[model samples]
Target: MTDPAYQRLGLPVTASPFAVLRAAVRALHPDTRAVRGFRAARKRFYRQMLCAHAARQAAGDRLTG
Candidate 1:
């Protein structure tokens, strides 16, 4: 069976947790990384996603990633 989280993130099933997060940050575009607002938003978004995913995993729920 495939990992739902990785699949939803468009990452390989073997991807590490960090890789999944990096992908999320990348999704918002790297060019905006130097912008303070975008940088803060990206960090918040990544943190939220990571926490949510981990919570779902702990609950035995299959995340859509």
Candidate 2:
């Protein structure tokens, strides 16, 4: 099944995860290092939440404001 969290972020889970992440990062116009750092940070945060709680709890936080 596709990851609902990614879908909520407007990402297609059907595509390769890295590709989706790279595209999203590029859309932000971040430098290569910044993109890598952001991805690393996201991975760490999600890992901690998943280990301590659940994937649902670590859901994507989308701000529309």
Candidate 3:
């Protein structure tokens, strides 16, 4: 089965951990940095993205390690 974390991020399962992390960081970037409430939303989203990436990494290790 594919890692749902990668799927959620629209990345391939074969993507490296660095790629996943970069993607997660890139996702938080916005064209305009002045939106109201963006700070709070980004914080929550960042947490979720970290959790998803961690889950993907753990799952990959289980499958291959």
lDDT of 3 by residue, 1-65 (tens): 54454466786556666777677667554653357667786666556666676677788789997
Could you give candidate 1's per-residue lDDT for residues 1-65 as a string of tens digits? 33454346675444567876887766665577767867777777777667655654655545443
> What is the C-alpha lDDT profile of model 2 across 3-44, one tens digit per residue?
444434454323444555554444443464466657776665
RMSD of each: 6.2, 10.1, 4.0
Q: Which residue segments of model 1 deviate by more than 4 Å?
A: 1-8, 11-15, 61-65
lDDT of 2: 0.45
Off by over 4 Å in 3: 1-22, 28-32
The 0-to-1 C-alpha lDDT of every candidate, in the order given, reads: 0.62, 0.45, 0.65
Q: Cα deviation in Å at residue 2, candidate 1?
A: 18
Using TM-score as the measure, name the better of candidate 1 and candidate 2.
1
